[model samples]
Target: MSIPTGTVTFLFTDIEGSTRMWERRREAMQEALKRHDTILRLTIESHRGYVFKTVGDAFCAAFTTATDALESAVEIQRKIDKTDWGEAPIRIRMGMHTGTAEERDGDYFGRAVNRVARLQSAGHGGQVLVSSSTQELLADNLPEHIVLKDLGSRRLKDLDRPEHIYQAQIGGKEEQFPQLKTLDIRPNNLPVQVTSFIGREKEIDEIHRLLNAARLLTINCPGGIGKTRISLHATTELLDIFHDGVWFIDLVPVSGKDGMWQAVAGALSIRSETGIPLDNTVIDRLKNKELLLILDNCEQLVLEAAETAGALLAGCPDIKILATSREALSIPGETVYQIQPLSVPSAAEETQGEKSCAAGISEYESVRLFIDRALQIRQTFVVTNENAPALAQICRWLDGIPLAIELAASRVKMFSLKELYERLGDRFEALNRGLRTAPPRQQTLRALIDWSYDLLDEEERELFMKLSVFTGGWALKAAEVICGSTAPLPVTAPPAWRDFIDPDHNYTYKTEGSIATYNDIKPDLDVIGLLERLVDKSLVIANQTDGSTRFVMLETVRQYGEQKLNDSGKSRETLKRHLHYFLLFVENYMTQVEDVTQNIWDTPIREEYPNIQTALKISLTEKEYYEYGVRIISSLFTYWQYHGSEMEARVWLEQFYPFPDYIQDPLTRTWITLMFGWILSSTLD
Candidate 1:
């Protein structure tokens, strides 16, 4: 590349309020440009200038002398001012700088070009600004003719030192004409501590890769899993790579569809002179610039945000967007990274001491974070030979989830690690005492989860509670059975209640303990609809894979749901119906070879076996067993035999063995006889 070694002045000019001029009164701006185009060309030519190109409504041009460039800029503004339409007048911003610029084939090139462009962008619309070099050159020649205000030195792109700038005044007053093109405004002072992202190196690396290549990258994870923190950290890491500074838009604060664009405009600090539409203007401004944008908390308004992001990506090739949410935006060229939870310590390793706990935790991110935070709270918190095992066991009990671990760790000031470990099962009772300072939503582990719970509808809340009957995980069909049992019937108290017990006694005694059977049940809800609503509300934790959706419940969530279910004002009959529904579902599964085999020992379901077993043990009354339990156990025989858990099957059958009605019925009797005989033979042999 040959370098040019002569005095050259680069001129960068922007059309102010171009979007408003084009969109609001497009015909008028087009007509004005047409009428003024000839005059504009002649003025530049007379000053020995050549128009390089136009950016939206802005234009770049070249001149050999700063004086000539300044004169051309003055005439263009003068001609536009002279040719005015009825409602809106034409306006523009012109910036000039004198520096030796290299000629690349036919186009102008060099750092001077970049400086002039940045300087032009700094000036408000309807103003002409020039660097000190150009101002001095003009002052030396025809200083008395044109008015100039010495604006102090300011920062521009790629320049360390502030450059001296002067704005030209027309007729001793600043022009009040509107800008024709939309201009870019940089948002100021982002949130502090974005780099405090505790873990997730692999996720951050994947996000960085996606942003570097894809037009859109979405970070998706469960609530309290730190998607927001990770995205912000990634943004902070990527700040240096983008020319235009990173823009952070917090979506959680925005309430409506229109508020999204307003938030974005506010973040960019856009102040339009004529109440311009910020959306179209923002798109146009970002089109030609290289920028990194972080849009946080997009799940609630995913469709709206996705539409906007898609438009931005299509319009702005140089722009990359990073969005964080509980789900994906699903836009084109979008890459999604699902963040996983932190590592939790294993039960055995933590039993020895802090050393073993720390060693186990070092293998997983979540457990490591828990240890680090817990240690901060208690200085004596060491992964010693003694505490290590207990810490590991505690982390395991908490599932190594960051939020749960954090809450668990916060109790160190008031509770010992051993106390926390022992009370892990009663999280609400244990963690509720500390952190009155935390937000109401995050005050306790239960409160944090309840926020998501409280957002559910009546049906969703009830279904979520009923789902807690399931231990760790369960099949969707099983949930449907459990929730659907008495949906078709209205709830009614047992006849014994109305006949023998008074209302006050029933309330008091019911709180003490209550029990009823399915024959007296009433169903008030549509089970299918309830399940759908619960799944929709996210009150039910669903695991969908390989074309099937499974659901499971956290113990804490289950307890919350059960409380809601009882409070839903249902009679004892509805509760019985709910229990019966689960029994009938298990029975249905026993009849189907495919159903029993498919989920008999698989994950999430396998985890819930204890709960299922307990439910079966308690709810499989003589009447329900004769009605439904016989069929389910028969279907499960194959599974039990394969897994060598014939003892569990036989033990469950012991409840039904005395219910001779089921054993006598051929349909139920045959499967029961076979399973019982098999278990007997296997044990005896």
Candidate 2:
């Protein structure tokens, strides 16, 4: 008999109505069981997820991340649901608990596992229940949009105390977030589970479709939306696509750019001359082979990544790049797809009554993801009349972001649907407060972004603030004119000292001043260096690389940078300088865009699109720039529509309309009218 080696979280899933299904359609039921077994094993292996045994309709598995364990359970169910078994449908109820269990050389043994197995008996068909600890550990790393329905504390068999359980409700259909793993980013392959994936079916299908057509493709999405999960899933699917072998390059662990190249080179077992850069060596080796390359987490080091990817794309037509990022690398002929959140049941489907709930929205992937994840942890979980509205409200409150949903799901052990609803009502606040000691920035999603802001140096921080003045995406030249004219003052130095002399006693004193005092500061400004520092510190994410280095400001970082600008009492001047900068850049950007017009672009805007939009929106609405707003809009008409900036453009036009006639030129008036007409026409339908 084999003994289980390490302590693990046990997940036992039992198929409900198995006997009836077998009796009704023995042949179909057998086929369904075969499919179920395949999926259960495949999901476990995907996350390096582990399974102990399979007994008839029940499966015993384990995972390291409760989120992953929960996610694996959900994925298994989803696969089962999609399987065609002729007439025998299989619904499973899963129960999981995180605790130390002895893996006695293959056969597992422990009270934690035993308690969880016992809990399975209490579960109704298609439900999931988990211990409180499991919920807490996996909370932060979960996708942002899925909401967990807390079953609250429940008395279970063979346990002296009440166990807290949660059921997940995946909502916010069409919303997707980049799912974050542990921030350590070390190269260690820590065991994890594929907890839940919201949306991305279309993107996944498209990717697989392209897999047959092209050898390399990159999948990009914003942070905290399940990019790693999707990449891993794609790798699993591509196992068949690539008969040679499938491999993954976890870039998060490699500390430097060269290290990344070294990792890939080693993984592919490529040899090169002692002095040659590993990147070149690796490219040379891969140039002649067909391989599937899944580059996980490349948003932070886009330039290095782009260099490597471009080389590979050029040298090796057979190699494919499946990358996950908050932004995309605008390589020529590269296809960019945006992954969204799971769909929520429409309000019409949510009945209003004392026990009113939303049901029958199972067709939506968001709901399916939620119910499927919930059923993996709770024995009696359901999305019926009693909890539908609360569930729906939770999804909406989370902005339908998938990572947010998974985090909320982990809190299920602590609160009920109604209580969870109330807690989420203060999500902005709740998510910010750290329940335990963690990286101060990881306390909440907002704090994570805020932490990035706090790390920027004076100049980088200032540039971030000024850049926010842009209404939409701007060209590199625009950024250069706006932010490059004056370099940001360095935030740190060993106290620059100036020599002073006193003639009376031949005594000397040293005086120090801010970087602002240095005349050469502007001349010595290193924008690229500053950007590299910002990216390294995670204050800003370096996105794509073609000619311009694209980047993004986290919403939290934007807010914090704005606050810094305000506190410094430089808001007015900074805003003025920012406006001037854009004005200057617009002239140059127009030259670049003259051929394409405002509407047609074959590639995505630079990663700095969000920051630019934030800057522009603030200029028009929050800043006291009535006349300047119209001028800014007139300057960047092409940018407004180029970035899908419909709402912001409309608002700018509205703000421009009230300004005196002198401020609104014919170009501004015509653009505003056309934009307004577009908004009205689009909304009427």
Per-model TM-score on C-alpha atoms:
0.55, 0.44
Per-residue lDDT value at 625 in model 1: 36
- lDDT by residue (tens digit), candidate 1, 432-452: 754565556667766766667
Instruction: List residue ranges in candidate 2 displaced over 4 A.
Output: 1-199, 269-276, 345-356, 360-363, 367-384, 433-443, 447-685
Poorest lDDT segment (10 consecutive residues) of candidate 1: 506-515
The local distance difference test score of model 1 is: 0.63
Candidate with best lDDT: 1
lDDT of 2 by residue, 614-660 (tens): 44654565434444455445545445544565576666666556544
